[model samples]
Target: MKLLDSGFRRNDNKLFFLTFYDIASPKTGGNMAGKKKGRKISGKKAGLSPGSLVYVGSRTDEPVRISIMDYDADRIDEIPEATLDDIKKCMARDSVTWVNVSGIHDTAIVEAVGRLYHLHPLALEDIVNTRHRAKLDDYENHLFLVLKMVIQEPETIRIVFEHVCLVIGPDYLISFQEREGDVFGPVRERLRKTKGRIRKSGPDYLGYALMDMIVDHYYEVLDQLGEEIEAIQEEALSNPTAKMRRAIHDARRQVVVLRKTIWPLREIVAGLLRGESKLFQDGTMIFLQDVYDHVVQVIDTVETYRDLLTGAMETYMSSVSNKMNETMKVLTIMATLFIPLTFLAGVYGMNFKYMPELEWRYAYPSFWGIVLVVFLAMLLWFKNKNWL
Candidate 1:
């Protein structure tokens, strides 16, 4: 697996490039392999205590890119690859600031941003740990959210599941992502064009916009997965092979992983709908409700894929079984047709003096005639029975 490219950009500008981690391309036509050192498969920090600042993600030389956008109805100021001082200045502003952190491989930068924003230790911990569960934390001052931002692998029917952590504060929206592609590009485009109410709304709406972009993209992924499932189903019914079987299993596994990562997000958004955090303004509740609805749709599509994979697997098994049955039926017919021939041969093969058939003049030809007749009779019977 490898990430060819990913980052936040405006005006067609290249925001950042990931040089260290590239788990975007799956070698085996499925999700990223668990053994890939780039994804920080769990158990790396077994003895480390909670809130440890170690970055439990890919060891990437790609610098942590921070793009800050401070916007209001009056004006908007965008900073590309903002430094610590710039981030400090952004936090001091009264405008709705969106600080997009592209890579979290450097715990130092993440720690600095957390300290500047006064984020909770646990939130900071979750930011660097890619394996953290999808969850939400309301710490009175701000709301921390951990969720998966799914992106599709190009030219392949697979998904790139990247962990995104966010601290939705009253004045700012800070997003932390593993070294992966940009899923929040649309949000930046919206803010840049001032196309929607995002500019007029507060950071709550910005957070909603971010989540909406991610949730809406789920449909695109689902569409691709649906096509893959259909193709697998057709192949399973027609030309089922071991490769097709593995594909169905891989598809099912991807669906299960998707469900596990996305199910908690529904709860997280529902928590916002219930007004669990004060950071979410009343106006934001409707948007959150819409997001919740999209999440439900995504989950439903995932379940449908799961069912399709299950049916395809059964269909493949049934195909193989029918094929085996046909083979065995032919073999059984051949063996049955040869039984009498074998008996006749055995009688003639014996050297007993009382063997009358061996002494007959037409016995050899007669034996062949009987054998041919028995073979044709069995074939005709099998054809009549529709078992041939």
Candidate 2:
């Protein structure tokens, strides 16, 4: 784990978005910082004191990038790596301001952002700890939200997971993402074009837009898993193997993870709707209700996939058991057919000098005839009983 001691440097990739009262905005190119290897998010913060500002994510040499978007209804200005004064100025504006920070690996910059916004220390702690679950917190001045963004990686259908935290203030919005990606393309495009109500709405609407993008991506991720579950189910029906069981387990695990991510978000949204948070307006609540409904739909889909995977696993086990039983039955029938034949051979092999049957000239031939008849009769009986 990298200690928070090397000083903070902004990464190359920074996303800045701002929406003002005038609403017109222009797009600016922002570089995405490359990924780097680091320690596990959960274990990195172990043995540390409470409220420690240690970053608990993979170590990335890429400096934390901060992009600021200052916009109003008339026009929008884009700034990459804006100084502290710029952020404060944007916050003071009556128009909505969105400051997006791409990397949270640097504690100093995160702490600086927190201090500028007067965010609680615990909220900063949660922001640094990537393993934290989806939650919502109200600190009078602003609303803090944590949620998971699950996206499928390209080329391979593997699920890529990241934790995002959003802090919603009176007229400013801040988003912290673990890494750089185009997951927010739709929202960014909306910001650039100013086509929809996102530009016409307040900061709460912008926060909702960001969260909505994250939630919308869940369906795409779930769709991929759904396809996998179908493939595994087909394999289980046709030619089942140990691999199908493993696939079922893996699919179920993914569903479980998605379920965990989506379930909490439902509660968070519902709580916000029910709780008196002045940050959210009546119009925003309507949008939030829609988000909650979407969450329910995603959760339902995940649970359905989970059940299907379980059924596929059960079918595979039953198929293997039936195959084994049929094999044993065939072997048992063969042994039973040999029982009478073995008895006859054993009686004839008894070397008795006074045995009349053994002395008969045609005894060997007659014995063979009897053995043949017995064999045919037993086979006929087996066939009649439908046991063959």
Best model per lDDT: 1
**Ten contiguous residues with the weakest lDDT in model 2:** 16-25
**RMSD in order of candidates:** 7.1, 9.4
TM of each candidate vs. truth: 0.86, 0.85
For residues 110-168, write the lDDT of model 2, one tens digit per residue: 99999999988889999988878899999999999988876544433235567789999
Evaluate all candidate structures by whole-model CA lDDT and list the values in order: 0.76, 0.75
- Residue runs of model 2 more than 4 Å from their true location after superposition: 1-34, 41-50, 351-368
Candidate 1: list runs displaced more than 4 Å. Answer: 1-49, 156-158, 354-356
Model 2 has an lDDT value of 0.75
Find the candidate with the highest TM-score and give its number: 1
